[model samples]
Structures are given as structure tokens and as C-alpha cells.
Target: MGKLTGFIDYKRENKEERDPAQRIQDWQEYDAPFSDEVLSRQGARCMDCGTPFCQMGEEIHGATSGCPIYNLIPEWNDLVYKGQWKEALNRLMKTNNFPEFTGRVCPAPCEGSCTVAINDPAVTIKSIERTIIDKGFENGWITPRVPKERTGKTVAIIGSGPAGLAAADQLNQAGHTVTVYERDDRAGGLLTYGIPNMKLEKDVVERRIRLLEQEGIDFILNTEVGKDISAEELKHTYDAVLLCTGAQKQRDLVIEGREADGVHFAMDYLKGSTKKLLGSEVDGEQSIDAEGKDVIVIGGGDTGADCIATALRQNCKSIVQFGKHPKLPLVRTEANMWPQYPNVFSIEYAHKEATAKFGEDPRQYSIQTKRFVKDEQGNLKELHTVEMEKVQDENGQMAYREIPGTEKVWPAQLVFIAIGFEGPEQEVLDSFGVETFNQKADAKYGKFETSEANVFAAGDARRGQSLIVWAINEGRELAHKVDEHLMGSTVLPSYLEV
Candidate 1:
């Protein structure tokens, strides 16, 4: 370690965020970058623990304990501590292909598993990581690394999200001729659309895509594989095909008045907003304007929070979010101890913005939406909900039961259903003859293979919806699998192999 007693000398410091009240006025990242000296001091706080559980990258109790990509966290922390910025960036890029994306959005399970977090504040791993990469770009250390020779083996990647991008980056480095197919007008699938610009600005995604293009990977946009181009045609044309299409089949609220005009799927609403921000045609229709409308966002996850933040920015009259489950404890409970992802309640950026703008937090836990109430014009007018309590079912399993006579209604001119995702769209799977692992089954990792030869799947498409870090991990692992299939063996590093 560069500083053996640095953890004792330095206190944990996090990156400063822009004032929530001012940041919500526009669609831009709110985090203010840290100076190199401050970032180095933060990196010095990483203790040289014997086990270094921060990079263990294991799943404990169905939740990730550390970085899924197994980033060499301590190594870079040491390099950064010694003011070796270039060395830190090199170590960071060794495990993570896109530090900028993960640094901005990942929930930082790595920090939760940090040794320091057992008794004190954890090292600022995410912010330090962002600084290292951002400095790399600023110093021109990151450049296109075009392969010296092509393997002459062609590969087709279906999807341009994190998984597809990571796979393309790896396969291109391995000297394979890679062509990525995206159904959207732009290359980035979720990064360009599903996530709001306020969280991750569009230019950050585009910069990486441009670098990939310069490195010999070709991108074909607005071209659906199973629709615009047949899967059979791709199978015949390319040597191997990898599916990273992502899990986008939204879980619907199949209650009454689901056909109301102002009710929309979360992705549709998010994509529409992002498209309008980018000056792109949003399905050739105007953006879903939440201005002056009472908004009700269902689901208590990140997507729902994004909806709340977006609505606030759009100058909505009022905002309320509903979560089916009970509120989590403000601190980690005995059941969720160290090294596992702490199931504790913490405010995210969007929630902070909501609180700052609305004078109170907008989340209401243990509430379930019963149905949408619509006006005569068939537009949503209100949302009916009932408070729920946890109770034991007949089988002695925990279940939610509605409190009798606890029904209530809230004015809602627009409703965003952000419940969750079921899995990948079936059309893409059916087209490729792929069989999905039953989600009900007790499998840690889902199936990634299709019935057809040389066809593979990864990320959300195979494993269902998950974090960006997990998606990158899946893409890197899948790339090695595809490479092995083509060359009879592979030299690509597998982070999970640890």
C-alpha cells in the first residue's frame, strides 16, 4: 500500500453535489468533480485489509457483496494515493470498460463491503474512480486502440446497451470483426434513452460510442434484428451471434382503467422525455408533458424516483410515489450485516431533489395502487390506493394484506408505472429459438444459451434486469464464451473465474 497508515491519517470525503434546488432546474449531472488532491486523499483511506472484501465480487443472500466486475479497487486506490493518476486509470480500465458510467450510476455495493464500513464511513471508491477516468480523458491518456490485425471471424451483437457495448469493446480488442445492431435511432439502448439525462448526460455515452467506432467496431442503428433483419439471415451471415437486447418487457399494473390516456409505462415516459431533450422525434409525437399535472409514480425503485425528479423538472403540480413493500430501516439491521448490500434506507439524487423542491419526501411506503380513475375524456384524473400490512399467509410465508377500510385516493392527472421488468422481450427470444431459464427456479445465474448453435445471450437479456456493473460483468464473460466457441479456446480474462 502506498500509505500504510493512510486510513488513520485521512477521513472519508465524498464528491460534492450541486445544490439540489438549482440542479433540478435543468437536465445535467449534478455532481461537482473533485480536485486531484482531494481524490488522492480519499483514495488513501482504503485500508489494506487482508481479505479486501471490497473486490470479492460474490453474491451473498441474493445480493452482490462487491464489484461484479471484480475491479482491482485496492490497487488503483494505492496508485491514486501515490499521485500516480495514469497508473490508477490503467488499473481501473483493466477491469471496467466504462468507469464513467458506473461511477455516475452504480449504487456502490463495493463501498458497502469495504473494511472501513464495518466501523466507519467507507472509502469514496466511486468518486475516486470517476476522478481517475475523467483525468485520463482530460490528459488524452484514453485513445482509440485499433487492433493490429483482424481475426477474419465476424460477430453480430444484437443490442447497444451496456452489455452489448462491453461485448463489442472486448471482441474488437480480441481482433474479431464486430458489428453492433441497435433498434433505436441511436446506438446506446438504455444509456441513451431509458436513463434520464439528469443522471447521465447524453454526451458521455456518445463519447464512448465514438471511441468504439474508431476502434474498428461498426454500429448499425434503427435496425431491429428479428424484425427489420431476420435472425436467420444474421445466423447465416455472421459466424457467431450474441444477444444483449436487455430486459425491457415492463411489468404492467393490470388493474382497472389501465387504458387511461395519461397512464404510461415507465420506459415509454423516460424515453420520450430523453428524446425530447435530445431534439429527436419521440415516436413522431409530442413529449408526455407533466406540466401542472398531479403525478403519481408507482414503484419505489430508481425508475420511480427518476419519474418524480422528471416531473418536478417539468413543473408538475404535485408528486407522490408508492412502494408496495414496507419502508427499509434507516440503518442496517442485524439480519443484513457487513459485506452484503445493506438493505437500508438512503435518499438518492432524485429523492433529494423531490424533497428539496416539494418541502418533503414524496415516497409513501406500504401502499398499493388499486386502480386509475379516469375522467369522461378517458384521461387519468386520480389514483386509488390502499395501505397494506405484512402478515403471515396460510403457508406461513410473509405476505402483504390490504388494511380493511384504509382505501384512499389522490389526484393524479398522470401516472407512471415503474413497477419493474419481467424479462427480455419474447419476440427476440422466439426469433432466435432461445430458451430462457425459468425465473421461478432457484438458479443463481440464468441460462445464456439459445437452442440454436453459436447463438448466445448475456446481461439483462439472459439474467433479467440488474445493475450496470452486473451487465458489464455479463458482457465481458459472454465475450469470452463467444471467443471460445469460435477459436476452440479463449485468452480473455473472466472476472467471475476468481
Candidate 2:
């Protein structure tokens, strides 16, 4: 620790955010920058715990605690406190290849597991991480670290999302010839399109992609393997093939009138918004406009929240978010003790913006959509829903029961289904002759290997859709596995070895 009593001297301070009403007018990030002194003070708040759980990266009760990448939290916090910005950035980059992405989008499970959080507020670890990386870029400290030697072994990776990008970055560092294939017109899979610019600006993603390109990793965009290029072609071309194709098959709302117009998947709506912002599409051409329409977003996860934020920015008339499950407790319960991911209610930035604009929270918990009402022209007009109550079934499993007289309908011209994905699309898996462990899109691979000989799988394609941090962790670990498989040895550090 930099100072023995640093924690006692400094109280926790988070970064200031733009007012909800003002920030919703534009798509820029809502957080305002903090000065070096304030960030250093925030870093000083890290207590000298003999065993820092902040970096443990352990899964407690089926949820992640601490950082999934096992970032060197204490080390960087100390370095920052000692005015060692470059050294802190070096330590941060040691484990995480994309701190900027995680710092912006990650829910920061590390803070939930922080020892200091047992009583008082946890250190602003995510903000400090973002500051370290942003400073590195601002000072030109972050440049292309081109490998001194090439292994001459070629590898092809599918999908350009977080997991795919992380694997590409690590494999390139290992001196292997890496070429990443993306299905989209651009390189970043979800980062460039799925996420709104309000959360993560596109240029931020492009900045890192430019750095990766400088490091000798090749990127082929608008190419979908198994369709444009056959799986056998990739298998014969490269020494080894890794599938980082994300779980993108959206779960559909199978109900009456689901085929009505204006019913859309959350990703399609979100992707359309980004594409329009980038000028890829003109007005009245494939644009999912929420303007002046009663919008209903189904699902209660981060994707659903993003839908709410997007609708607000488009100036939707009214917005209502429906969650299948009951609302979580305001505080952590005994089952969710310290050092575990808390199952408590939180009003994220989008929710706050909705509250500010509508004069109340837009979330309607414990509600299930029964059917989509449509007019004669097959346009969506309203939604029928039923309230539900949670109860324990005979097998001791939790289940939802509909309330007898809670049926209701709301006017909704536009509906976005933000429910989570089931798994990766099966076409890509079947193309490679890969078998799934279960009924989902998850490939049956131990660690990350698939049924095929030299083919591998990682990230959401293998483990199902998860957090961006988990995707990075999977990518880094999978890279080490692929490197070892190719050369019979690898110098790359294994995140799980710790």
C-alpha cells in the first residue's frame, strides 16, 4: 500500500455523471472525467487486506465474485496512489486486454466482492481502471507492441465480439498469424453495434481495433463462415480454427400475434439505431422508429434496460419495461452475503433516465405478456399481460403462477423483445460438425475444444451468453489452449492457473 492509513484518510468518491435529462438528448457517454488528483485519492481508498477478494475471480452460488479476468487490483491501486500512472497501466494490461470495454460496460462484480464493501462503500475500481487506460491512450503510452518473431502458424477465428477480439489479441501476441472473420460490415461484433453509443462510443471500439491491426492481426469483415466460406475451407486453410462466434440467436416471444408488424428483437432494433447513427441507412429505410409511439420492452436484463434508454433517446411517447420475475429486494439478503454477487435491486443509468423523463420508474415487474394485439392491417396496437406471483413447486423449484384477476392490456405500438439468448446459432455449429452438450447452442467441449480435430470454441458460443468480462476471460484462456495445442507449449499466462 502507498500509505498505511490511506483508507482512513480518504472517503470513496465516484465519477460525476451528466444530468439524466441533459444526457438523454445525445448519445455520448454520461460520465464526466475526473482529475488525476481525485482519481489518485479514489485509488488510495484500497485497504491493505491480507487476502484481497477483489481479484479472486471466484464463482459463488452460481454467480461471479470479483473480476473474471483476475485483474491485479491492489497492485495497480498502489501504483496509482504513488503517482505511477504508466506502471499502473502496465499492470492493468498484464491481465486485461480490453480494460476500456470492461470499464465501460462491465457491472463491476469486483466491487461487490471487495473487502472494504463489507461495511462501507467499495473503492471505485472500475472508474480507476477506465482512468488508467484512458490516460495510457492520451499520453501515447499505448502503442502497437509488434511481436519480435512470428511462429509461422496460421489461425482463423470466427466472430469479432469481445471473446473473439480477446483471443485474436492474445494469439497475435503469442507470435501466431491470426486472422479474425466478422459477419458484420465492421469488426467489433456487439461492441460496435449491439451496445448503444451512450454506454460505449463506437470510436472507442475502433481505436482498439486499429491498435490490433497495427500488431499484425488481420481482420476480414462482412464474411460469415459456413455460408460465404465453407467450414471445410477454413479447416484446410489454417492450422487451427477457433470459433468465438457469440450466442446471437435471440429468444423469441412465442405468443399470439407475434407476427404482427412493429414487433422486433432487441438486437435488430439496437443495431438499426446504431447503423442509422453511422449514416449507413437513410430515413424511412429499415429504421425502427420509437418516436411518439407507445413502446413496450420485454425482459428485465441489461439488454432490456438498453432498449428503454434507446426509446427515450428516440423520443418515444411512453415506455414500459416488463420483467417476468418479481422485483429483487432493496438490500442484500442472508443468501447473498458479502463477497458474493448481491441479488439486490439497482436503478441503472437507463432506468434513472426513464424515471427523470417520465416522473416515475418505467419498470413493471412480475408481469408476463399474454398476446400482442393487432389492428386489421396487422400492425401492433396493444399488448395483453397478466400479473404473476412466485411460489415453490412440489419439487422445491421456484415457479410463477398467474394471478386470477390481474389481466390487463396497454397501448403499445412498438415492442422490443430483450429476453436473453438461448445459445449460439446452430447453423455455425452444424457447419463445423460440432455437437452440443445439451439442447442449447453451447458446443460440447471440455475447456474449449469441440468435437472436431483442430477446431476450438470459446465465449458465449461455448458457455452461453454471459457478461463481457466473462467473454474476455474465455478468450484469453482459449488462446493459451490453442497456442499450446499448436506448438506443444505456450508462454502465454493462463488466467485460471492462479
Candidate 3:
């Protein structure tokens, strides 16, 4: 929309990452922002597709097609192309409350569904978004916008993760008093602890929290809802309660010698490293020390990749990642076509660091753990695994079957399980009498409302562990629902219908 023939002349260009060997030595972000001229040219690459599917945010064939939060991509791209930095920031903030966070961590499904991506490189939407927010901060353009009026109603939100933060931001903007409860000493849940510092700096999260405080949202830290304060007490004190606790129940690896001393959950290891980086002291004996030890990371998702990278940063002797599924192809397969999330193989930054330092890709695909072997002192000494074959289940769905004669062993002292989360931890949900629907964390249709009236749930707590974009989507959607229920009507926007 900025220029008629801009897409024909401009090619896509993204920010350059620092060299792997150099970047892994420090816990800092690797990607550098593009200079003003280059970023403007990158924004010029957005095509005038009659129907911009990038904003549709639909899941086709078990894979998402576009931005889950449905950001107004083309509008901001045009504004950026015209050197309208403030305008771009305003447009970006209209739908996304935290472009800085999403710009850094989101997978950017919008780019994959871009029409340009069909035959040419898609526009550098993620980079432009990051640049817009960074500029907003640099120019002192972003400040707290406190509401002009206050509703009599007050909301008590449990959990200070992304979902909880988003809900608080929305309710405060709608002229309601909002208070967020966090179990940790700090405010951000995973953003403060679970994620590695190299990927996202702690200061970035704190800056946003400070802005929220300036806007009048109160935060109560080191307070567990069901434990520190009774659920009945919160129910009586607040006008309505919104449950935004994350899905943190880790799936355990049940096998022989499972009680070995060195075995630990992936979150424990990650949270420990983050706290140490933030100058928080960890408790003695239970702390994980990867220094000079052979590390084996189970599971093959982003968390596992983070574990491999963090181990290497800790100067571990060696690292190996195990995956139960087969390796994905480099290109799209017949089963996973474009407009859907392609099951294509790609190297994450963590894997790249592992290969650079260890002389091999740390991943061992199509392998499943059979058992854990312990040393004489009960410390984990070795891991036994077997290759798996994909077989059809009774319902004709693919399932993993262990191969008969493909068992092998690898040395290890530290094992981190990153298989994924099941649902919200049971104690919090049970405390509120919230029932599960669809065997997952998500609420049933027509009823995100719990058994008790006006009590709502959202995010990973209600929808199971999911993407950051989905968390934002849920927060925005739930805010509208809460608003409608409170006032019998709402002016707040909903992206799903937009």
C-alpha cells in the first residue's frame, strides 16, 4: 500500500545474528537490529495481496496458518516504509500489548502464511516489529497510559505470566482495579525464570513490568494463591477472579533407576540458571551443576534446545539430545504443505551452538529412553535408549513402537526431562473447583466461567501449554468476555472475530 511496485523491486532481508562461536560465550541476545535505511527497505517488501492471509490466524490440518493475535501487519509495514516510527508503534500496540516480547520469542506464523513466502521471501515482519518497539522506548514515546475513569469493580488475577500480565493490562485500561499475584519473588513467571537469559534478558521483562506499575496495576509477589492466601478469601475479597496460572506439571520419565541423584526436571535446571544469572541465590544440594559433566537432555522441542545451549554455556563436558519422533525434512512434505505449519527441519540457535562446540548436532532422533542406569553412589551414570518405528494405531493414527534390537547406551550424570507439560498444576485448579474440558486445560464451549459465577480461566492453565501468541490471543479474548459479563456489554476488541 505504500508503493505500488515496491514488492517487485524489494527483496526480503532480516537482522543478522552474531557469529555462533562468539555469541555463546555470553548470555546476551545474538540478533542485531537493522539500521533505519535497511529496515525501511525491508518494510517495502510487503505485497498487496487481495486477501492477506497472514492475519487470519487459522489452524489448517493440525498446523497454524497465520498470526494467532492477528496483528495488523500491512498497516504497520506501510507506516514504517514512510518513516513513521511513532505511527508504526501505535499500530503495533493496537492489537499486541507486548510486541517486544512476541517480537523476540514468537515463531512468527504470520510470515509463513505471507503471500510473498509462496514464491519469494516474506517481509521481515518480526524484525520491523522489534524495531518499532525499540524505537518507541528509545524516543521516550512509550509511557504508562492510566485510564481516565475507574470502574467500581476490582479483579484479582493469579499468576504473573504472559497471560496474567495481558489480562491485567486490559482490565486496567478498561477502568477497573487490577492486582496480579505471583508465586515467585519476581513478577514474570517463565519469562523471569524458565527462559534462558541469552534468549531474553531479565531487564527487558522488568522494564515492561515497571511500565505496568506506572499505569496503576498492583503486583503482589512471593504469594501463592491457594497456599499463602486461601481461595475462599480471594473469592470474597475481589469482584471476580481470573486464573492465569501456567501449565507447569512436568511429565516424568518413569524407568529403572529413575531415582538417581543427578536426575532433575528441565524447568528446575532452567529456573536455577536464570536465578543465578539474576543474582538470586539457589538453595544448596538441589542445585544443578552442569560444569564438567556429561549432560543428556530428553525431548526435542524448544525447551530441550534451551537445555543443550545452557549446558554448553555452563561448560559441560558434552551434550546429547534425545527425541522420540523422527527428524523432520528440510523442505515441506506432502503431508505438511504451505499455508499450514510445515514439518520442515531447521536448526535452532541452541542446536547450532551445540554443533559448533561439540562437533556434532546434539540431537538423536527416533530414539526413546528405555531406562536410566545409576552408579554405585546412586548418581545417574548412563542412559539406555532404543530406536523407535512409526506404526499405525487401532484408529489408524501413527504411534511410536520401540524397535526390537536397537538398544544402545550413552554416558551421563545430568539428565533434564523436557517432554512437555500436561496441564495446570492440580492444586490451584482443584482449589477453585474448575473442571477440565476436552481432556486438556482449555475450558469447554460457552463456559470459560468456572462452576462458580464470574470466575474465569485462560492461557496455559486453561488451554494446556501452548505458544506465546496463543497466550496473548487468550488474554485478549478473555478480557472481552470478562468485560461483557461485568457491564452486560463491551467495547474491548476481540481478534478472533476481527
The whole-model C-alpha lDDT of candidate 2 against the native structure comes to 0.90
Candidate 3 — which residues are off by over 4 angstroms? Answer: 284-286, 393-396, 437-446
TM-score of 2: 0.96
* Candidate 3: 10-residue stretch with minimal lDDT: 437-446
Per residue, candidate 1 scores C-alpha lDDT tens digits across 1-498 of: 547787889888767899999998999987899887987888888888898898887778888899988899999999998999999999999999999899888889999999989988889999988888888988999999999988889999999999999999999999999999999889888999988888889999999999999999999998987779999999999999999999999999999999998998888889999988988888733369899999989999999988888888899998889999899998889999999898998888888888888899999999988989899999899888999999999999999999999999899889999999999998988888877643323223434566789898888887788899989988998888888788888878877466
Write one digit per residue (lDDT tens) for candidate 2, span 85-184.
Answer: 9999999999999999998999999999988889778888999899899999999999999999999999999999999999999999999999999987
| Candidate 3 lDDT over residue span 372-453, tens digit each | 9998889899989999989999999988898898999899999999999988888887787777633232332324576777
Model 1, position 456: C-alpha lDDT score: 85
Model 1 regions lying over 4 Å from their true place: 284-286, 438-447
Best by lDDT: 2
Candidate 1 steric clashes: 0
Q: Scored by CA lDDT, what does every candidate get?
A: 0.88, 0.90, 0.85
Model 1 worst lDDT run, 10 consecutive residues: 438-447
Q: Assess candidate 1 and give its TM-score to the true structure.
A: 0.97
